[model samples]
Target: MERSTPISRRPKAVALTFDDGPDQIWTPRILDVLADYRIHATFMCVGKAVQRNPQMLRRIKDEGHIIGNHTWDHPNLTQLPLSDVQTQVLRTTEEIDRVAGVKTRLFRPPYGDLNDDIVRKVTSLDHEILLWDIDSWDWKGLTGPQVAKNILGHVRDGSIVLQHCAGPTETVKGTLEALPYIIEVLSESGFTFSTIPQLLHLSAYR
Candidate 1:
């Protein structure tokens, strides 16, 4: 379906979303960080990764984070045949449902790449495209300070900030390092961290 508009928007809040995860290594540690701050962020999980670590996905849900699908293999949706694109999404959705016991309508295209046809196909599966407003670029091996600057420099009320905990060690190291500082700074500014559902007032799972 079409992506959601605000049912009611929360003020002075930001949504922290992690993509391509349910990672066995960094995810648990990242979750620990979120727990320490009593924050609930969103995790956009890939199917094969989840298969390797279903328990991690379960942990994500058990701890109250909303889980969204990031496709089976993180393919660019606009480049695939529409049927293949649908399969990529459905397969991941099914895996998430099996592991987490929830069906999420939230779907984020890999690399934020999508076209009208891709959207039509994904919407056919009842998924609402969930893209981010802020990209930390942590995947490119930006330093912790750089990652913090990327987010803090652009953050605003109701912004969706993207970071990843699942990737090469070097790629995620900066993100893990920057997370606490970013969270603390944002919190001190009276900005609350929200999961996507909370920010947008949409159902997290169905």
Candidate 2:
């Protein structure tokens, strides 16, 4: 879905977003798990990765998942000049649009570090900035139980979950191991997943 109705007009929901994909190995595996549940998640893709693997980008879109820009290179936007920040976001959006035949309306800053300048630039592009309500810490060397515990501990209505598809070797290992349990717990708890844009409607846009 491109956008969700206003939150007051919509049912309670959460979003699970993965950043820095579509990775050859990790992204596909992640997609499989989400598909098994018939759930949709959003992928914030790096532009160069999308360029290198257009087919994977198509697959993400074809499977009913939304794509968002995470930049051409996953850089700390707070450290870059305004021009660089604009380039990072815009380039990724163009790459995603080219492969998916859709222009994504959401963007997540790499590292979740958004300064006012970067926010203004991203907003100027007409993309909403996505911040997480739940930080699973899958990027940390936490075991499956730990990751599951971390998420379930904080999950609530309209939560946005942060997970990683790209990271240090250790971080990626933790994410892969923890994912199944995380999905199962949230699914059992009567929560449904959607993309960032889908989670943020008029009533919940704050």
- TM-score against native, each model: 0.95, 0.88
Each model's number of backbone clashes? 1, 0
The sequence of per-residue lDDT tens digits that candidate 1 reaches over residues 1-206 is 21223324467999999988978899999999999999999999999999999999999999999999999998877888988998999999999998889998998998888788998888888988888778998989999999999999988779888899799998899999999999999999999988898888777777
Q: What C-alpha lDDT values do all the predictions have? A: 0.88, 0.76
Q: What digit string (tens of lDDT, one per residue) describes model 2 on residues 111-178? A: 78877778788989887777676787777767767777877888778877787776566666677777
Task: Point to the candidate with the largest TM-score.
Answer: 1
User: How many times do residue backbones clash in model 1?
Assistant: 1
Model 2: weakest 10-residue lDDT segment is 1-10
